[model samples]
Target: MSKTIQMPALSPTMEEGTLAKWLVKEGDTVSSGDLLAEIETDKATMEFEAVDEGVVAKILVAEGSEGVKVGTVIAIIAEEGEDVAAAAAGGGAPAPKADPIPAKSEAEAPAAKADVIPAKAPPAAADNRVKASPLARRLAEAKGVDLSAVAGSGPNGRVVKADLEGAAPAAKPATPATAAPAPAASASTPAPVAAAAQDFGIPHEVIKLSGMRKTIARRLTESKQQVPHIYLTVDVQLDKLLKLRSELNAGLASRNVKLSVNDLLIKALGVALIQVPECNVQFAGDQMLAFKRADISVAVSIPGGLITPIVTGADSMGVAAISTAMKDLAARAKDGKLAPQEYQGGTASLSNMGMFGIKQFEAVINPPQGMIMAIGAGDRRPYVVDDSLQIATVMSATGSFDHRAIDGADGARLMKAFKELIENPIGMLA
Candidate 1:
């Protein structure tokens, strides 16, 4: 019997995706666990694997096809020893596979290769009917370049204009035979460059947005428009926290667990949420839901936009544990290798732009998350100590809260608790 392969949802929010590339071709032999293709979802580009062992009969959807809806038939597989041509003609819903592996694992499994967009190979004759934008096709035709021999840079491996100028010379067509011959230049004079087609106008370039970039813009815009935000700002001294971190790191040097300021801040915010439970909440349509355990979403910037990977049960984890977990999450997040659960659903978020020397800024709340704390750079500034002015290292932290879910007093109280945790240092351990 022939088996149909449908486009599986790569993430909980995935509706459509770009078929980035195919790992196998018609008549290829493969095992159940072998990779078949790469799928580009809004969150990441992930590898898709085969669940049923068979011969690759046909590839229905061409590589680089974009906006492929979930469950769309992409390929067919014929059972071993069956004719590949017969299976190519067979059609129906990809019936349930006897393989015990769950369908959810199709997207949830760790990728064998972690790159979001790996270097594309110039298409071959077998893949000549590649998925590409109309513009790219026309440009390829005009340049006497074969679309099959050019690597695509657009979404889902679709060839774009940038590929024309940027593709290796060896991949493009030979220079036009009828063009005017260039005059040889002497050592005193350099040959003049030819004018471009658009030489009459100012130069500009167009950049197509990736799936991840597009989603980031849409979600952040919607959040700002619909969510009523109340922001509270505070300045806290960091000297005590710094001193405590140094002392702790020296004592635990043998463990090889070095805590970052952000890691400690995560612990502080997690503990603060537990102490002031009123602030640990999400805004539902009719009512607010308060959570018992604090799961912190720490924002880490990637190539396209920002992603807040969750630290599950952060309030219960020690600083060393948080450091180790955070490092792993950040590394994987950058590589587009994190699993769905690793980056989804959080009660609150923490965004730190201090690394870029930002003084302070308000962050839009990612809903159903009621709040996000924005951290600024720690810099030296004058402060009052027993009414005597002194210079100290301090940072401005701003908390953006959903007014519908939390009160101003409660928001202020949460900030006060966070301030105390950083300033006193010892309180975070307690």
Candidate 2:
């Protein structure tokens, strides 16, 4: 029998992606675990692999195709001893349904599918079976509409989003007037207004937005509009920390490990979060989550946009280990080869622009994460040492906190702990 291969969902948030390239062509033989193509997800470009051994009979989708939906057949393969021409002419046989990919963390999971409330009315289907697309299901649940009542307009009578338009939700019983009044609904962020297209007649080329760019634009806009931000700044002396880094690098020279200032800062932020647990939290609608361990997400600038690759358990890792891990993560991130788990979940974030000579700037908070620590360049400046003015190496650090979850006092305490750790330079080691 022939087998059909569909486009796989590389990440939990991926709905559609660009088929960047195909490694195998028609009539090529492939085995299990062989690289098949490169898929460009919103976060990264990941390589897809083959699971069955066969000969590539036909390519259903061409390379560089954009907006290819998940579960769409992309290619066909003929089994061993099967006629390639026949398989190609007949298309490919249907493959067995595969299990959905499991999410690595709660934050990465889709809340719409997990928390949907069922409608009160029974489904209209006589056989008690309903066929709908994932998007249609989500919309139906949100609107309290029964899926069986709606007629599908998609392939093979599959319900789609268009079918739910103008559909009313099932009615519920009204509360008694004598009972206590219900709580007011929370305020929602206003939807963005679309701008009218205009051309100034300038001679320029038009470039389409990539998936990564679109995601970045939407996420950052939502973060700024929804999250209430509180900014706190502190100047830390880096002379002692710099000296310690030199000594540690010399000791680890034989191990080929070199520690950057950013590595030490990552450790500091992780330890500080542990010390002041109040700062490590996420604010859900009705509850707050307090984490026991600290996972630091380090921001790396890629070709199209920025991605944060997480350094898990940064508090307990040694400086040398942190350095090694960061080097590998950054290298892979730039090449667009990081897995979803490597960049998905984190207790907090750390963004360093010291290399770009940025003195100080406030960073936008990544949602679900309470705070982000911004590091600035360390340069020579006038400082007060023991009530006397002296020149010292100083850097300005800013912490952007979500006021909904963390209070100003707790944010200050975290900043104090981070400053102490950096100044002493030995407390982190102990």
Candidate 3:
């Protein structure tokens, strides 16, 4: 029986994928769980595996093919020894393509050869001391330098411009002077000619935009141009929160775990979201849909793209659980091996550039999610606390809300609750 191998959805946001590489050629043997090809999604390059055993009959999608929608037939598998191409053309069953098999040892591949030069050439004396044109020989004789001593600086190592100039002066070698260094040669020579001023100019390379870059550009452009965004700013004192994180980390470190201030903030946000469920609402067309679970998405940067992997049921997880889950997700994200369930179903997002020293920034809301938080670096600043001027560690968190789901007041109220939670982090443990 012939079977079609359609493109699979590698990620929740992937409507289509690019066939980056095909591991199997036509007529190869395939088995269930064998890797068939590599597909580049919006976030990463994922491996496509064969689910059944068969011979490769035909390849509908070639390597480097793009814009293929999910579930679109890309290849066909045919019966053993069957001609897949002829079968497919005749509207008959196609043959299966072989999946890539991994090599078990380095000996299976040929070793690279080493480059070496043989040393059996004639010695300098017998090799005819020097080869030079008659005119050049005359010039060297006139300059009183041995031709053998001057390496040819011209084409094919032939002596040319300043072979004579580079030769030492004919005077006998002088004795070294033993004295204090005289005023370092007062005359400064012009900086060695500025690398000849690169007439052709420095070369540059042109790279085509990847799928993720394209999506980011399009969405951000639409967001800035169409979405009416309003800004709200509030500073929360973070001295106590910092102390709490340090103490908890000191104790946590004994258990082979470490936590960052961002982790604590994520936990705080999760707690606040439960109390203010309005912030957990999503804009579904004309309706506002609220979610019961607080799935918090944390933005992680992979080599070629950015991905937001979620912490499911974050509202119910403790600070340590949230921290551990986030670390696991981040590690897998960097490795490009995260399953679809790891990245999908986030009700809200948190983007912290504080570790990178960004003071503050406004972020675009991820679609369907009513809000996204942008966090900045915490620094010491002066503020009035009960009519007394004091220095305190403060940080700012800004939320971008979807007006269709959350009103201005609703977003503000959620942010206000978050500010209080982070400011009084001890209350978050409750």
Candidate 4:
């Protein structure tokens, strides 16, 4: 009997997905655990594996079909010599029908087969291409200059009309016999022709949005529209903390552990969250959740994207352990190999742009997690200490929280406790 292969939930929060690509085709043999397609979910692009082995009898959905809800039958698998027609004809236990997401036509398919060669532009007007701006074309036609003779300053090397009218008139030699030469145009005067518009090379490159990126967009958009968020900002004094970090790094340098301010901040935040559990909370379904353990997500940015890998049970780990775990996670993050557990289940998050020299920033709270802390660059600035004006190391940490899970007062209290832990590094260790 043929079996219906429905789109499975690739991630915990995946409700709908995009069929990124199909590895197998109709009439192709498949196995119980063979990869069927790559599905782009809100979280990541993950492989969709077959659960029952058979020949691919029918394909109902094409690649790049987005918003396919979970359990939608996307394909069928049948035994050898099995009737594919019978399978597709809605016979034998009739598979549930999906509302049918419109599929892309073969001509519009994004994937190119290995044997396919892309068509090259004809070589004319070959060596030079024609690309003219509306104004330039109008001016060129009005001025009676041939656009083809003009070189293109536009993108993809297209000839713009400006290229024609702006062409420098050939410098003529002075002949004494002529009536007083019309006043020679001064070089300093601006030309009547408009300046060339900057060609930002193809308005945009079509990037296939990954599952996580899509999910991030949807979730953030929903958060911004539905969930009310309130932000609280606090300045942290880093003088004593900086000295402590230097001492710790010097002591642990032999152990191949270099402690950064972020590592310390993570440790401190974990401890502070333990003290103020109200901030370590989540609003899901119709219930409110307060977590005791702080699973802090540390945001890491890579070349093509950004991922936040969680340091689970951060409240239970020391600075050295946090540093070591972060090093491994960060390496994997850059290489794009972090396992699901490594990036999920965070009760709170920390996003630091200090090393990049950003003075201040506001962070969006990662959904479900009630709050996220945005850490800014540390700098030496004037401060009032003991009735005297003096320079001191200071950094700003802005906390963004969901009002549904935490109030302004709760946010302030949490930030206050967090500042103390960071200001006195020993307290975090304790």
Provide the overall lDDT of each model, using Cα atoms, as 2-decimal numbers: 0.78, 0.81, 0.70, 0.74
| lDDT per residue (tens digit) for residues 146-237 in model 2 | 66777665434555565688887766436676656655522321111111111223443324467788788888898899899999999999
Error (Å) of candidate 4 at residue 205 is: 7.0
Q: What is the lDDT ranking, best to worst?
A: 2, 1, 4, 3
**Candidate 4 weakest ten by summed lDDT:** 102-111
Candidate number of the best TM-score = 1
CA error at residue 268 for candidate 3, angstroms: 1.2
Clash count per candidate: 0, 0, 11, 7
User: lDDT tens digits, residues 203-315, model 4?
Assistant: 33224445566557777798788778898888888999989989999999999999888888898889889999988999886899999799999989865567889988888
Work out the TM-score per prediction.
Answer: 0.76, 0.75, 0.70, 0.67
- Whichever of 1 and 2 has more lDDT, that candidate is 2
Residue pairs in collision within model 1: none
Which stretches of candidate 3 lie above 4 Å from their native place?
11-13, 81-204
Candidate 3 per-residue lDDT, tens place, 1-430, comes to 5777888888767777678899999888899999999998766678999998888877766677555667777788776666666646533543222211112110111111132121222123344555433334444444445666666543234443234565753443344475545344213111122222322354433234577676667777876775666556678889889999889888888777788887888887788788899889887765678888888998888876678999888777888888888889899899877787777669998999888988899988776577888999998889777699999888888888877677888888888988998878888887
Q: Give lDDT for model 1.
A: 0.78
Instruction: Write model 1 residue lDDT over 263-303, tens digit each, in one string.
Output: 89999899999999999999889888999999999999999
Q: Order the candidates by TM-score, highest first — what do you get?
A: 1, 2, 3, 4
